[model samples]
Target: MARMPSFLKPPKKIAKRQLELRAQLWPDLNEGDLWSRHTHDGFSTIPSTMALIMSIMDDLSKNKPVSSTYLELWNRSFDEGFATLAKAREIAFHSGFSSERAERTWKDRLKILHNLEFINLQSGASGPASYALILNPYKVIQKHHERKTRGMREDKYNALVARAIELGDISLRPADPSPPPTPMAPPAAPFTFPLPAGSAVPPSPAAVPSAPVPPTGVPTSESSKV
Candidate 1:
């Protein structure tokens, strides 16, 4: 095993950075659960598998958003084949894992993920089969709905609409809330005649002006004070 090149030295304060990154990446998914299941306490498989998936997920997040109005995605695929397996093996080996364990993890762990429907699988004719799932379409729907409910941007909203249409069967429209009953105007008070043209509203009797009355006693019989 040749020594790692000195020029490729680890960064200063990398431990804190690594911890911060890990916290950001796996922030108490559900108290104890991380986003990925294989990352549980009993991780006997090659650690590289989880690392690879996490890296893929990060890449997917950066690239293929549910709907990208601002970005042109640099889409990448995790194909199932010799090259991918070899890469996993290499990561595991570099992480102080035995080659046999790396190979076993490459086979066994990914099968678990596939069985759980975490990855989409496609059969290949005379070629290596492939599997993928960066962001689950259902999860994407949930996330987009949350965004819309919380007020997403117009461009993003339009992109999501386009993507929803592209997806065909997946409905992005919220359930019609049976619109607020059209607010019937209380039958318009059942008027028999049309209102008069100007100031048709009659003043209340109390609001009408009254004539001024003479003083109670002093002007009762005032015939010009004769």
Candidate 2:
């Protein structure tokens, strides 16, 4: 078997640094759970953060990094594929972000590619060089096509909309006075003594009245006289 590189070897210091960086990155990550999973019983002071970093690193090293959003969209059979930067720019413009901010957000993701050593630093093109997720080579090609398909074609989209209306593909717009949903019928009036079919809600029995007992011991005055 070939020997592994020393730099790539897991070092105690690097492991600590990895944990520190991750803590800074995501403070909410459960440190105890992560440490227990990676290290046995937190006995080792070395940062368990490296364990998490290496998990992602191992995936990349194995050439099994997950798919990029752009690539995933290309694989879908939707008539409209993924968006290009140009289309994204239009969306950002409509969404009220400055062009520069939108572009910067995109370019920043390219730093991950540089970190992974996938692209040369000198490449004049500035976009995401690599994606966090692994994608098949065929899918990468498909993504390129998808981006092209999503190019800015306002005229074409408008024409398609008109055609759809003519073909009765679109529904008529409701009147402005359309009533609300009737408040969901007030939750079916709750279960007011509602019993299932054939199961009569047994009527509450009436209170029994005390019977009047005649005075048995004492005879009437007339009877006594007789």
Candidate 3:
């Protein structure tokens, strides 16, 4: 029987999961979204650091349950659009995040996801940590680029690694797509407040009485003294 060398130990299940999560979370990281200056900062500096943030964002995007502690932050400050924190938590607590640091983990991951446009940051007194889940732009660009560049006869991709020369670096960031149009709701039907039946409508501004005059023969001087 052959024994495994201590130097080449078997990898943990979490490592594979973490990698899978990252691939799903950020298929194409955009230059615009990357915090180059702050990239080296915090726990995210770990090799798979950005993946963790993407996992958290992915969880939120799926409309899953979240830690109540973190949900409290959104309830008081962040907007999740239609779904409340409590409602989200019910789905989340049942789905996963049963661990202790579940809440703190979310808070930390969200901090790294700060540049996401729809996420609102809470500053000043009684601050709460929360983020709004929006569509990831990086993934969209990759799909579009692939569609346009597909079927090209680029022989370099299959050439020997040592001899292969690649073209310009692909850009992850794309121009912000225009937001969806919000329905106008027909101007709310002009908000007509019903008047009592058979009652005469009040006079228009033109017919309303003008400013009143002082009583005839009233002495302004004597009135002021009294």
Residue 168 lDDT (model 2): 58
For residues 82-170, could you state the per-residue lDDT of candidate 2 as single tens digits? Answer: 22333444433443346567644434433433344332233223243321332232222223233543332444334434544564543
Model 3 over residues 87-152: C-alpha lDDT tens digits? Answer: 333433443445775545555544533433224444433245423443333343234235543321
Error (Å) of candidate 1 at residue 110 is: 1.1
TM-score of 1: 0.23
TM-score of each: 0.23, 0.17, 0.22
lDDT of 1: 0.41
Angstrom error at residue 25, model 1:
23
Models sorted by TM-score, best on top: 1, 3, 2
> CA lDDT, every prediction?
0.41, 0.41, 0.41
Worst 10 residues of 1 by lDDT: 65-74
